[model samples]
Target: MNRSGKAVIVLLILLAAASISLSGVIYYNLEKEKSQTNNLSVEISDIESEKARLEEKIDEQKTELSKVYARLEQNEKKFKKLTFSIDEEKRKSQEVVSESASLRKDLADTKTAKVDLERKITQNQEELDSFKLEIAQLKKVKDVLQAKLKELTGDFDVELGKIVIGPEDASSKSSPRIDATKKKSAASNLEGKILVVNKEYDFAVINLGARDGVSVGDMLSIYHKGNYVGDIVIERVDEMMSSANFLSSNTKEKVKEGDKVVYRSS
Candidate 1:
């Protein structure tokens, strides 16, 4: 072959080798670039996931904040209600204090009224005692007047066929004695003197009986020395004497030897 043709062939071989080398280098560079692109895509996905999580946490915080605000509003309303209740309680306490003071005044008034009633009762008791004393004095005066009238007009002894001597000496008189010599007759005065008394047997004998209009169940008021003594009821009787039992004992001294006796009226 010719020399120029050999040189051309050699040049072509060199160019082909250069082309293959360049293509291998370019392929290696392209593979490395592809690997970097894949890594970048993975990093982008991780970043997106982190951003979504952060947004969810923000929403949760917002929800918690709303709940807190609601609770705060409820606490404020409760505080206001408590203040109103305190004011109402204070007003009721004032009313209760006023009522208590009024009740205390009423109690004091009642105590005063009770003391006044006791004083009035004591005064009334004193008046009753005075009346009893006055009655006793009046009875004594009446007895004295009657005795004076009997002395002035001796008809009481002559008409009745009895004497007006003292009770101690009247028994010795012949007419007053219950003997066979005396005559039984209806008595006008219906009066008597105690002749005998049996305190152990609770009985007494008077100088008046059937003839003196004395009957069973007749009450007699007895006196000793012008002092009121007691009462007695006639239980038995004879022609000139009546037997009686004491119905009541009033004086400290029991019925005695010369006690004056008179018929009692209701």
Candidate 2:
């Protein structure tokens, strides 16, 4: 009875040890699997966060590209404006150059005209010397005649407002007498249209008179359109009108109605 009880007790102890060892191994394996599962969950969370960050970065880049595009469009508009300004300035420069060329031609023509006028003036001076010499001879003859008249009449007789000698009677002097070319006057540079013209009487009527500072004896230059026609001497002046006699004329033109009249002198 004792031996059988001892053997049964030993077998029960052995079975209990094996069962505990098996339970310990299963617990360890389960714990390791649980730790691996937790690590996987954390990795998934990290991946999701990374994806969100990447999406945000993409949106930021898109916003930046839109800004760049807007700036490019504005720059293009500025470039167009600059190009237009340059073209406009170039056109204006060309016009100015053309005007400069025209002005140079006009200056050359004016110089040529001045040379011709100077030549004509020299010709007139030669004729003036001849006339002055003739006048000197006439003065000598008049002096001899005056001496004979004084001897016959006992005294030299003279009349009022009449003189035998003129104010410019220095014949013995070598200096020449010169008539000056009348200069243009600012106050007398008035212009008016002719109201009437008379070829037979050689007279014309003008609109400007005393009220416009025009008086009798005032010389006026006449022009048909812009071309020179003649000159006129004022004979009568009314309140707002005047009558002028033709004093001179161009060989090819005559004073006519609607012609412009201004102050003139030779």
Residue-wise C-alpha lDDT for candidate 2, range 121-222, written one tens digit per residue: 455455445444444433433343343334323321222112223323223222222223222233286788787665544677787755467777888888
Pairs of residues at least 3 apart in sequence or in different chains that clash in candidate 2: none
What global local distance difference test value does model 1 have? 0.56
- TM-score for each of the candidates: 0.32, 0.30
Residue pairs clashing, model 1: none
Candidate 1, residues 230-252, lDDT tens digits: the string is 88888997534677888754432
Model 1 CA deviation exceeding 4 Å by range = 87-266
TM-score of 1: 0.32
